[model samples]
Target: MRIGIVNDMPMAVELLRRLVVSTREHQVAWIATNGREAVEACRRDLPDLILMDLAMPEMDGVEATRKIMAETPCSILLVTASIEANVAGVYEAMGHGALDAVDIPSVGIAGNASSQSARLLTNKIAMIGKLVRDAPSRASGRISVATDPSPQRLVAIGASAGGPAAVAKVLSAFPIDFGGAIVLVQHLDAQFIPGLADWLGQHTPLPIRAAQEKDRPQAGTVLVASSDDHLVFKSAQQLGYTSSPKDNVYRPSVDVFFESAAQWWPGSVIGVLLTGMGRDGARGLRQLRDKGHLTIAQDEATSAVYGMPKAAAAIGAAVDILPLSAIGLRIIEACGRPT
Candidate 1:
């Protein structure tokens, strides 16, 4: 894959160059000292992917991402010195189309720190490469609805990247007495789950909490997957976590949860794939659609990173391709609620 590097610090740029060259599977296509240069470079010659620094002199990563995407779209991964410190900027960039974020690996660290960081960056790059390769020819498969279309009682949502805000928007649209259970699988670091839950709860009328082992999902409540393990269902009401799909890159995978729901949930189910990077929820959303459940994917205009829903739509997994604002109302109607 051809990768571009953007950072203000000379040393950081050199380190990233070394890291990319060391991989051998990828090549450094170009280098930019700041956001302005990065945007100009992208317009001239767009790389398959970009390693963008969050903080830079003059234009910042967020603005660069916005411009590059608006002009010459490409996959972007935020490579920053401090992820915690730049959390807001990271999300902002993602909201504007950046795929994901990772801490820049420190060269001076001892022990296995360097190796661990290298592994993380390589894995992310490899994932992005696959997304780029498959994006162009992706086909949305046939949308199959259940012949009987059971009464909707469960809603399963999956999102990553710009998910927190998107999830909140959908959840907030529900009334306090929403007569169904909501299972949300968001790709986020484990440490941030509590804070994300609190943030989403603040915007929604339904009570929101992280899923607990052996807990049954209750109507009128939202269960956010909390663990690093994939969240799945043991039965119609019971939720469980597993490390069985240890090879899968995404933890608390949206695919895992949606597939489990297709098997366990007896009633009509509503599956939603929101703004996110990669194709994690695409296959699972298809599974739900094949089972006759209503499946929705966020349209590109409203999606922060359109990868997941794009994949879903490409492969015919989504029964409806709607904007983010319309999803909640669609869910409510699917659940037999009046418009």
Candidate 2:
């Protein structure tokens, strides 16, 4: 894969270069000293992926990402010195189409922290590379029509990349008496889950909290997957997190959770696949649709990144492909008011 590096610090750039070269699977396509230069470089020559620094001179990574996505779209991964410090900027970049974020691996370090950072960077790049290579071309596809005979009472939502804000928008539309429980799986770092839950709760009428082990879904409440382990439903009334699928790329995988709902939830389920960079929820949404569940995907026009929904639409997994604004209304119609 051809990867571009964008950072103002010389040492950080070199470290990233070394890491990319060491992998052998990827080569540095270009290097930019600042955000402005990165934007110009992308306009001239877009690479398969970009490792972008949040803070830079002339322009910031967030602005650069917005421009690049508008001018010459490409996969972008935020590589910053401190993720906690730049969490806001990280999410902003994601809202502008950046795929994910990770702390830049430190130079001349040999400890476990350094090793873990290195592994995370490499894994993220590889995963994004696959997403780019396997992305489906846009084409009008057929939607499968299916409906369960059982009463609908569960809403499973899956999102990534630009999910936090999108999830907030959807949840904010639900009334305090929403009829179904909402189970959400978002691809976020474990440390940020609580912050995200708090952030979303401020904008929504329904109660939002992290999913707990053995907890059952409750109407009018949004239970978010909060751990690095994948969240799954062991039965119709029980939720649990597990590390069994350690090999999966995205932890708290949307696919894992959606599949579990398909297996255990006999009641009518509504599966939603929102803006994201990978195909995690596509197949699982298909599984739900096959079982007569109503499935929806966010349309490309309103999605920050159209990869996941595109994949779902390609496979006829989504029964309806609507824009972001319309999704909330659709959910309400399907699930009805909280009982």
Candidate 3:
């Protein structure tokens, strides 16, 4: 895999460079001193992936990510000095289609997690490299149509890459009495789930929290997949985590959740596929639609990556291909009226 490095600090750049070179399967494609240079470099020569920093002179990573995604459309991973400190910028960059965020590798004098951090970064890079190679085609090939009947109502949403910001935008439009139970499946590391829920809580009137074992989706509250394992409906209306699909690249896969929603949700469902990279949610969304449910996919113009929704749209999964701003309202109308 050819990887690009973008950071203002010389030490950080060197560290990243070494990390990339250390892997026999990966090599450094280019290096940029700042976000501005990154955008320009990306324009000139796009790599398989980019390790981007949030802070830089002239242009910050958030704006740079927004631009690069809109223009060149490359894979990006936020490699910052402190992910905890730059939580807002991390999500903003992700909303612009950056894949994931991690703390920069540390260089400690003695006993510390420096080596582990370095390993973590490499693992993230490898995971992203695999996703890059995956065919971004119609993912509805394996999903089977559901034949169960239901009287309740559910909104099952899936997003990746630029999900946090997009999800927040949609969730914010919901009124307190927006009475449908919501289950969100977002592609991200498990540790970040709490932060995502907290961040999203500030944007909407509904209570957003991490989904736990035996949890059932309820009205007026948002449940986010919390484990690294896949979020699925283990039994009727009971949400649980599973590690069965050991080879899935996107952990807590959107497809898994949506498939569960299609099979187990004891009600009318509205499947919403939002801004994301790859075709993670397309199949499951189509399954929902096949069961005579309303399904919405975010349009390319409003998407950060446009890969997942594009895949969904290509396979005739979405009943409506709407922009980001209009998705929430559509869901509310479909869900608010009790099918």
Candidate 4:
């Protein structure tokens, strides 16, 4: 796959350049020092993908991504270095149409900064390549739903990076009586999510409904987080969507739902982090794990991009790392199944 790298830092630009060179299937088509250059290059060359940096000097990645997507239309993968102190900015970039993100490794940490940087960058590049080249085509495969329905506990799932197809696979695997609530957060456009929810619901037994401002999460139904607002749970056992201050990078963030589950149901909550491109669910999953709630992540093999799951695993936030098919069964088992 041909890719473009956009970053103001000379070291980061060189690092990414080497990474793309080493990857057998990927090539760096062009390198832009700022968002303005990125936009111009994208319009000129139209690379297959872009590795964007959030904090550029002339123009930021978010605006550039918006322009590139509108005019040139290519997949964008954000690469930044400040996740510990500034994770929220990453999500803002995503909201502006950047597909996913990765942390830029510290320069000169290993024996060879160039090679180490390349190795780290290579993994992310390959994943983005998969998303750019594989997801749309692969989304057409028949989704497999689970057959048994004796379980009683419902599970709510929310994610962003690489989530659209991953959520569908897990939902499609459950049988009609899987016995629980299934809420989702896919970090998609508000106007289009209703249609996406409907499309995803067609493959699952539990019909997908958009979550109203004060609706309660009920059993045997799949409730999706509303677009343009954050979905949280109140002490009254009701779902609340508010325009309150955003906590993490993504407003309808996985952290909000997973953290709420930990608070609302404690041990009864089942939180699953699927293929995504950031750390949105990592902290919330940790909270769930600490509270003895069930936490799971989609294993690397089946993930369209494993960023979110990888983040959860890195922090010991997940109790299990399973493939897409096994996640639904794990949910059923956690909800207490016939097995």
- Top candidate on TM-score is 3
Better of 1 and 3 by TM-score: 3
| Per-residue lDDT of model 2, residues 1-339, tens digit only | 999999998888888888889867899999998889998998888888999999998999999988887778788899999988886787778767787788898655442236767888888888777767766631111112233233357899999877877887788777766667789998887877777777788778778889999998887778999899999998878999899789887788888998999999867889999988768899999999999999999998888777889889989999999988888888877764432
Give the least accurate 10-residue stretch of model 3, judged by summed lDDT.
138-147
Best candidate, lDDT:
3
lDDT of 2: 0.83
RMSD of 3: 5.5
The order by descending lDDT is: 3, 2, 1, 4
lDDT of 2 at 17: 88
How much lDDT does each candidate structure score? 0.82, 0.83, 0.86, 0.70
RMSD of each: 5.6, 5.1, 5.5, 13.8
List the candidate 3 regions with Cα displacement exceeding 4 Å: 110-113, 135-151
Q: Give the TM-score of candidate 4.
A: 0.59
lDDT against true structure, model 1? 0.82
Residue lDDT tens for model 1, 239-272: 8999979977778799999999999987778899
Residue-wise lDDT of candidate 4 within 1-339, one digit each (tens)? 988999998878887776677657878899999999999997789887888988888898878876775576667877877643334455455544466566776666552355555565676566556555434321102333344343234486866654656676687777665567677877654654666666677678677888887776666788888766777887536788766655344657778777777787522678888866656778888998898777898887776555677778888999999998788767766665432
Question: Tens digits of per-residue lDDT for model 3 on 1-339?
Answer: 889999999888888988899879999999998889999998899898999999999998999998898788889999999988988898888888899999998887852337889999989998888888883821111111221133267888899988999999999888776677888999999888888888899899889999999988787778999998999998777889999799888898989888888898877888999988789999999999999999999998888877899989999999999988888878766764634
- Where model 2 places Cα greater than 4 Å from the true spot, the runs are 109-113, 137-152, 337-339
